[model samples]
Target: MSRTPPARFTRPRIALLAAGALVAGAAGTAAAANPDTRENAAAAPGCTVDYKVQNQWDTGFTTAVTVTNTGDPAGSWQVEWSFAGNQKITQGWNTQISQSGTAVTAKNVSYNGSLGTGASASFGFNASYSGTNAIPTVFKLNGVTCTTGPGGPGGPTDPPDPTDPPAGARVDNPYQGAKVYVNPEWAAKARSEPGGSRIAGQPTGVWLDRIAAINGVNGGMGLRAHLDEALRQKSDGELVVQLVVYNLPGRDCAALASNGELGPTEIDRYKTAYIDPIAEILADEKYSGLRIVTTVEIDSLPNLVTNTGGRPTATPQCDTMKANGNYVKGVGYALNKLGDVPNVYNYVDAGHHGWIGWDDNFGPSADLFKQAATAEGATVNDVHGFITNTANYSALKEDHFKVTDTVAGKSVRESKWVDWNRYVDELSFAQAFRDKLVSVGFDSGIGMLIDTSRNGWGGTARPTQPGPTTNVDTYVNGGRYDRRIHVGNWCNQSGAGLGERPQTAPASGIDAYVWVKPPGESDGASKEIPNDEGKGFDRMCDPTYEGNPRNGFNMSGALPNAPLSGHWFSAQFQELMKNAYPPLP
Candidate 1:
């Protein structure tokens, strides 16, 4: 039984009420506050600090702080401040943060250490406070007091140099103001098909799914080749190159369609042979200008939550992977090594809502992610964000209905389709899961990416309005856009279509709408075929096979005559373009 579904898949405020000039204190200290939550303080004579309380609740708050270097360029930087109240930071991202009583120190991690003159680096933290959450009155950048008064050193007149790239510093969102790399290889394949030219130029993830992929697999583009092509595509400005960092030991434990080459205990080989080489290539200075976004280890960790132990969907392979601890260790090792590359942004693969949206799987999945992040010397900071629905066909949104909707006086979740899941679609699940992650110690600033590659269930069958209020099943079945017999039917889904075109900041907490799973690529073979890539023939990929507990015991719903996973499937491609939502022009 294959458990695979689709494809892989602060507040604060503290203000002194006035916008007043900074009051200089002894030893070159200066402090100023605005009517809003933002406060500026001078750190030494070379840096300025802007601290803003982003959100606040009864006992906790989140803050974003930016430090700008005003003096000579430095290879590294640090920002220090002291809280007036008994505030303790619970977790932080993008920097190493430590609190000594009320005093706090935030130091740049490996990737963001370089601070060019007039360059700024930002980091944020979530903290707990009792009573007042007063804004810090002073800030020190690299031990220098930051001054922001009129005509003062490091003041408003001398702003950060807009043209200067902060060496290896990361942007808030890598996709914003950037052109994503279009894989000429995948594009060529797409152009070969009739009308494929329409989406041939669109960006899709370069999947480094196996060790052979590190170098060219069967003379295909290697890691360096892709980066070089990205550089060519990027004439100037920023360019985001998406890489799918898969190939974990015991990979895709719950499914045979995408099984990996490595044995269950090959943690050392995964780190040394797989992640290490990729990290080395990414760290190379030649590729530093390109913003490399890596979707790390798809379909690995989530199995530990939903398909392990005594769960109805549990597999012996999943149980073995969970017991061996290679999944957590491998993910941690990957996050740690890949994160060291300054321009590389690591987004862990969070399974889509259909697989883990239930009450039992959601929280445990987040908790397991934290465990992986903290294991093998990896920290939450290594994860820049998370990507959901990497290769599966989960609808980006359900416009006609929601999980909260009550059809015939019963919640829509009770429907066989929803099956008591907390979320009805990918967007809601991603947002809510992000919140859950933060509450469990991820950085508050973390963003999410949704793979809209094949989720759009458009076509003649797409529902334009809500279903009749006859019953919950009819309401959900009639109005739903996803045509899958069950959400768990993930292998080369018959009605799946190209979702939203890749775009930046599509929604709150979403970094971008990505196509990580390139369209036309088969999820797995419809029948068992011999291959050296370690992929296997799973029954879920067979159109005639009955389903398992993971998919509610329905028909597999997979398309027939599919090739092996990752191979191009022309029939599936044409169908996707035909049914594309927002209909392809």
Candidate 2:
């Protein structure tokens, strides 16, 4: 059997700094609130606004406003209000604040943008006021005037407690009884190390772990071990076991740090030695009650498509892989054999939003997924969903960045990459990708899983919350945080934090958001070590190496002396906890 080189995987491009320097915009003028405008403030539309003065001084005052969406599920929103006096907002949080004359507009930040029906989100601002600090009467949501009287249509007479979940929304998963497995190994590792205690506050206890890498060279625990573990864990109420099937000939393409020991000529050995045994074990009748969800061959099929440009030079193994068609053969075999088991659910890894999030990319990516599904006797039904941002952190939301295309004369940031409207965050990308898959004949019910594990590193430059900005780079660099030296640098990146906790039914078009890559696992070693493992050092891991074309990043910001990919890195773990978004308790 001809073993082919494994396909390569790289991180998405980090924020590409604008060619021109950021031109700072004007700051709003200081003003005093006028008593006359206080009575004019009235809410309109299907929303209501409650503005309160949290603090007041002679020249400036602080206020917090709660905007409640009583109409529908608003994935994004804009709230507008005019000042009654000379009040001008100087700063704000949890919103994108903009001011013109006395008019003030606040747009939702990426994370806080989505408002379920009857759901309320709050933001606060500090403003300089002139003579009188009078509240403006006019308020609007998405341009419709808000009402100060009884709430508008579909709104509750009494404002629902802001802390309560939205009334008319199914904000959580419908499959209430289903629980995905959390690998005990990761938790054990965390507790044994420094900053491990932070793991207790995160979703680490609930995250699904991957059993990767059945390269022909490494010996793996037989199916018996997997089955026994799943059976034992099943008693704890987890109905499904999550396993990552990630051994391909020429694994990880020519990417040295992640190269699997399996060579391109090992297809026969791959099937007989790996997939066949794993499938036979999963199919056992005794383990029938355990639902096995296998993330089949990540970075494999996707690489065959992404690596066609002759860039990111593929290893000779990958060349044979393409020439011999071993990857497809292997994935087809795995999917088909695994699908044979009634208890198994297979989700082909689709890389992440950064990898295939572009318009030109998702369609082909979906087609590739479809191809994988149809390859064997395995039909689309044999595949359950697509996993994205697996083991990668491309932000859940990019709140501050906005772009206007010079040629198209439209906000390119708002185009396919951005959906032509809302800021293109991971959620938006996942939702769109899910729809594209459906259009291409995949089941509409096909759900998506996002690895929120390490993607949460908002860079040190990130604002505590969104505020006013006109310069694109300033807005992006200051308001949004992503610590990657470059987007393509995927190793143990610097400044990364834990992303959203594991959740089911996070939003429509998504089934479950998982932590497939457990937090604390190093993407790769910071520098070459004496370890004898086949994993080689990619210069991207060297803090001193400036950068390269394939991944224009030197990874100077990465954790130093980190272990090889998938091994423990204590410093990175500690940093992740320190920088976690929701702030580890």
Candidate 3:
């Protein structure tokens, strides 16, 4: 809900106008209205329960529970559950809730208690917990046990639906198999640490033993090795492995650390060398059920918008990238090829809130993504979602704001250039961006994936308490959103902490919040250290370096003399484990 600035872009105005009118007919409304339902009944008469960890901070959390009746019509219903940990339900919605120690009970509200057999109802609550915010295990509808919706029978969990499911309902996540492959390279490196933070009292390595990862194109193990690893992990049933199809011509223009080996002229090589080979293997019939979620380029398109205009600084490579049409062409080529594969889910990179949160940037960014998809011979169906904050840290919530801040004359909330318009945090930015994308011709079912790798670093710098502030600056500095040194700091930041663990059923409008930038993996080194990977060493990683005059940013709070991006840094790992919000398990 961005304010209408004095000068507004015509395209965004038109898009927003259409969006306002069409939003009611959008997909999220239906999905939210009807939680996932099944033809078969639950153990107690086909009641399905979807438990989602909605929002979480350091100690407190909010959860959403959707209970659907797939059996006979019920005049009234009661949902009961027991907390796995020492969880206590403090407040609830959509029902009358009461808690006694570990046991909790919720009777439907007068409007929703009585449900038709196929209809679904949802309610949520806010609660506090000290440690181990595990989801509740057992749920009963009127004393009858309710089966978990999709994750597994063992737990009452709601995994995100991967496909374009009916509105409000998500496709069953592809990563629901017994074991998903976490790149052994990263896991082994972290575990090999003789000493560092310990997980479950064991070394940090134990925690990453079975995590998931993507085999990136530029610096990662090649496609063959990644495919082989997927095959190895796919012992019996389907195997789901995440892969990043980066390394387009003019790979990363704004930053040097990630500049790729490909140049503008190497577009053919990108297709033949990179995307085609990968697509060929993924399309193999033998690997039919293998799910490959490929995050298409990062930092490329945002640079086209933000890096230009001489704001932060523009890059010549980006100019060349646009001129050559390589990025859009390469992305289009990848999507056209990859989309043909049945299991491959292509999520084009949509730079996070910091880059495109404003009204002008938001609409254009959606257009850029659409143009890329169109150039790549992709239909609306070819793409699944747009990933935000890829390999970057952007806060999930905005804790402070004032109604008066929207006033044009008396507002400190406005940045120097872009008006602080509608979005207050990454969540709002994402939800708004999703709507914008749908307006710009993407599918209504298109989901959003946020890379929440290092954003959960809430501390005294970020707002812990809220009250009236002197001005918008105080409101923003002490309250508004995000305590990151700067949103532009993409390198290994000093104070960053681990965000939410990779999860499926995220807040509404988000398909999955993934750890695209695997924790403990470096964003780039501070110094030009030796590395086998063919990544560039930019001065941005060096805390001692002066600054990138073009981007108009200083490397504030960056780790000095660190390892090259993607390498394990034990010190940072220990720091992340130490400051992890919601306390990592």
Residue 425, model 2: lDDT of 60
Ten-residue region with minimum lDDT total, candidate 1: 16-25
* Candidate 3 C-alpha lDDT tens digits along 251-361: 887787776667778889888877777778777776665666778877788778766655546677777777788878888888888877777777888888777876667
Best by TM-score: 1
Ranking by TM-score: 1, 3, 2
Model 3: how far residue 537 lies from native, Å: 2.8
Q: Where is model 1 more than 4 Å wrong at Cα? A: 1-167
Instruction: Give candidate 2's whole-model lDDT.
Output: 0.62
Clash count (model 2, backbone only): 37
Give the per-residue Cα lDDT of candidate 1 at 139.
Answer: 86
Query: Could you tell me every candidate's TM-score relative to the true structure?
Result: 0.73, 0.65, 0.70
What are the per-residue Cα lDDT tens digits for candidate 1 across 1-585? 111111110221112111111111111224332212334633324666767554454566556566767766789888888989999998676689999998899999887788876676767666778898888867887787764466443356667756444545677667755667889999999989997876776789999999989999988999999999989878765678999999999899988999989999999999899988998999899988988899999989999998988989999999999999999999998888887777778899999999999999999999999999888878887887899999989998898998889977899989999989999999999999989999999888788999999998999999999888899999999999998999888888888889876655656788888889999999999999999999999999999999999888999989999999999999999999999985664
Between prediction 2 and prediction 3, which has the larger TM-score?
3
Worst 10 residues of 3 by lDDT: 17-26
